[model samples]
Target: MEQIVQAECCGKTITISTGKIAKQASGAVMIKSGDTMVLVTAVAMKTAKEGQGFFPLTVNYQEKAYAGGRIPGSFFKREGRPSDNETLTCRLIDRPIRPLFPEGFLNDTQVMATVVSADKDNDPAILSMIGASAALMVSDCPFAGPIAGVKVGRVDGKFVANPTAEELEKSDLEIVIAASQEAILMVEGSAAEVSEDDLLEAIFFGHAAVQPILAAQLELAKKVGNPKRDIPAPVVNEALKARVAALAKEGMKQAVRIKTKVERHLAIDAIRDEAIAALVPEFEGSEKEVKGFIEDLEYDLVREHIIKDGERIDGRDTKTIRAIATEVGLLPRAHGSALFTRGETQSIVAATLGTSVDEQRIDSLYGDSRKKFMLHYNFPPYSVGETSFRLAPGRREIGHGMLAERALQQVLPKHDDFPYTIRIVSDITESNGSSSMATVCGGALSMMDAGIPIKAPVAGIAMGLIKEGDDFAILSDILGDEDHLGDMDFKVAGTAEGVTALQMDIKIGGVTREIMAAALAQAKDGRIHILGEMAKSIAAPRADLSAFAPRITTI
Candidate 1:
């Protein structure tokens, strides 16, 4: 039996159904908004894998070539690995719901969102997000979520929910906001010189618009949703946790305050070893619990100091920017190059100039589209003082590159003004925190180094939050530790005048608009300071490009 439900949203019909297709999946749902449609499935193993420390939640978003009436243009005549767009869409779906699952219920869950139909007017990214949430709601998994996503645009001072692809091109703001009925989970977007107040208003409006779609999904789940699984909670020896904490408490407390990452890591490991040697004889079969307890203790201590005492791990003020260095035209043969370093995070970005014949042609459901301006970000393990094999770019690399690209897209010259194709590559040589923001600063300098007439120099900064009960603190230019332990990862990019790109991911239920306003204001100040440092190296585009750069004489 097929159960279907519909809702009116943003001047369009949003239809959702289940039980008609993908019945083999543990849970499946089809979601439609405008002419765009997506089929999402939720599945999980009956039991978790042994010794799996992290919850394995995979969200795969695919665009079938046939969705937009196209065929595979590759030699294999089939879909290969996930494309950049697909990977980014996957991250969008993964960020909001990953934190909503029951603790210790890691049963190898996977949520797959396949775009079966694309209208080219409405993006399938948001539809995929909604569909994945609905599928999880109907599944037997212990997912504590019923989230929905929306795309909001600002046109002529009015907010438009689920704006069309055309309207987005003309609009000054392009934001995607995903939320539960009570709280927001994720936010990603780029805008013009919009104020903090207007941005908050747009977000609130988008939240109100998503209620209808969420309501429709809930009604559909009620008709065909399965009974949640009955799995017993894992046994934890409370005595083991207490003993381990008592043994390692002082050592970890001292380790947490170490300024450098390497020293802190080594110190924590030593404490763990000492505790294990002392207690392993008594607690023979409780390795996992002992280790988990120690980690939890460390997390609590670090979070407490930040929220209560305002003591950052690096011993810096909450709003202080890290030491920065920026330089341009380092590569002699390349068209343009710039090396940007802020504290430990660094990137050597290079710009390549080409002709119309060199543009990258993307063949997807949206048909063959050519991108004249592109950015690629690469991160090698060696850059992070580690050892690992290298392969194709992963989700993090793709997401970061896309973010830096969005940050620079607003400042690039129009197609008619700059007829040549441009591409920038950011090679991370070192990373500690906000390498994505480093890429943005590096990309801007590289373009200017190549004599690209960008409207203004763009820079980025990452902001973090530490929230405990009613208390909270926002940290600007956060270190990697703060980002890992903090409640929010808020990244903002723009010129000195205003913001051009913004992304926020929260681990808690949500944050108030007041916090967002404060973060945005702080980010602006940090961005201006970074740009001032960048101006010292090269303030604007050069008179001419490199002598060895590609020359394309337009006829």
Candidate 2:
């Protein structure tokens, strides 16, 4: 039987149907808005592979050339590797849904969204996100979601849901929000220096807009949903856990307060080795389980210290930002260069100027276009004090670079005013946490050093959260360890006047409006403090471009 559900969203009708196509998939749905259509499917292995230590979920979002009535222009006459747009969209769809899976379920799962048709007025990325959740809801896989996504824009002081491309052009704020019926799950987008209040309102508006879509998914699932598989409970050896905790309690307490990343890690490792060696014979063939128990004890201890004692691993308060230092013109031969260091993290960013001929030409479903600005981020193994075969840029690097790029995009001069093509390369020499934010600060300083007439300087900061039932604490400028054990990782970037870009992901179900408001307030203070420190080096754009830059003249 075919099931279809329709909802009116922002005066436009959205249609979602199942059982008519991709019948062999575990679960599949076809979603359409305007003339744009996306087919989303979810499939998972029935059993976990042996020795699988982590959940293996992969998401792919692909755009077909024929969707927009175009042919492939490559030599092979076929679509090639995933483009930057596709990769970014994949991350957009993955972040919110990844956490909704039930713990202890280690099956190899994959979700794919393909754009089957395209229209001039509608964007398929948002539609793809909705379809993903709907597909997962009806599938047999164990999922804690039936979430939905919406794009919010403010045009002429009015909030618009799922705004068209033309409306977005006239809008000052653009944000994509994903949420469950109860609270917001993920947020990612850029704005034109919107205030904290305005941004918070936009988020709530988006949350309300997605309610109808969520209802439609539930209705569809009621009609044709399959029985979900049961997730097995993880086994716990109480005796072993008690033994490990007793031996390592004192050592773990002191280890977390070592104040340095390298020293702290070393101390923890020593404790782990001693415990494992001492208990290997008694708890035969369960070294991994013993290791897990020790880690859990450490996690609980650290969270207790922060919540009850109001102390962090580095002895800072919940709202204190780390020390910052900045320098410009570090590379003489380069067009412009800056070194930005915050606490233990650092980025060396360089900017280069080029002519129109150097603009990156992108071939897409909508046709060809050129980009005047590009930001590239690189993370070598040595940054974390490890060694491995250095490869090309991976998904992490691309994602971080695009985030920093969006943060700076709000302040760039118009193409007509500054015709030179600009490129920024951010090399992270050291990283403990918030390396992407370091890139944001360095990129801004580098561009200004190159004499590019940007509208304003930009800075970024990453925030974390630790919640225990009714008690919760929002942290500012979190370190690497806090991010690992916390419940949320939220990043905010912008100038002193307002926020330009925001990204958030949470490990819990979702966050309340009150929590989000507090996090945003704390994040704004941290961002402003970072900007003040950045201003000590260079406050404005240089008086002239580098002598090596190409001179531009109207033809």
TM-score of each: 0.96, 0.98
TM-score of 2: 0.98
Candidate 1 error regions (>4 Å): 231-234, 552-555
lDDT of all predictions? 0.88, 0.93
Give the C-alpha lDDT of model 1: 0.88
Residues 144-171 of candidate 2 have per-residue lDDT tens digits of 8888999999999999999988999999
Best by TM-score: 2
Error of 1 at 439 (Å): 0.4
Query: Going through the candidates in order, what is the number of backbone clashes in each?
Result: 0, 0
Which 10 consecutive residues of model 1 have the lowest summed lDDT?
Answer: 546-555
- Which 10-residue window of candidate 2 scores lowest in summed lDDT? 388-397
| Residue 151 alpha-carbon offset, candidate 2, angstroms | 0.8
Per residue, candidate 1 scores C-alpha lDDT tens digits across 1-555 of 899989877787888888999998888989887778899999999998988888899889899887887888999988888888889999999999999887788789899999888897778998899889889988888877789999999888889988887888779999999988887788999888566668888888888898988888778778885888876777878888889888998888889999887788889888888877888889896666777887888889998888777778877778989999998989988899999999889999999999889999987787788999999999999787898776578899999999999999999998887788999999999988999999999999999999999999999999999888878899999888888888999999999778889899998888887788889888988999999999999999998978977765557
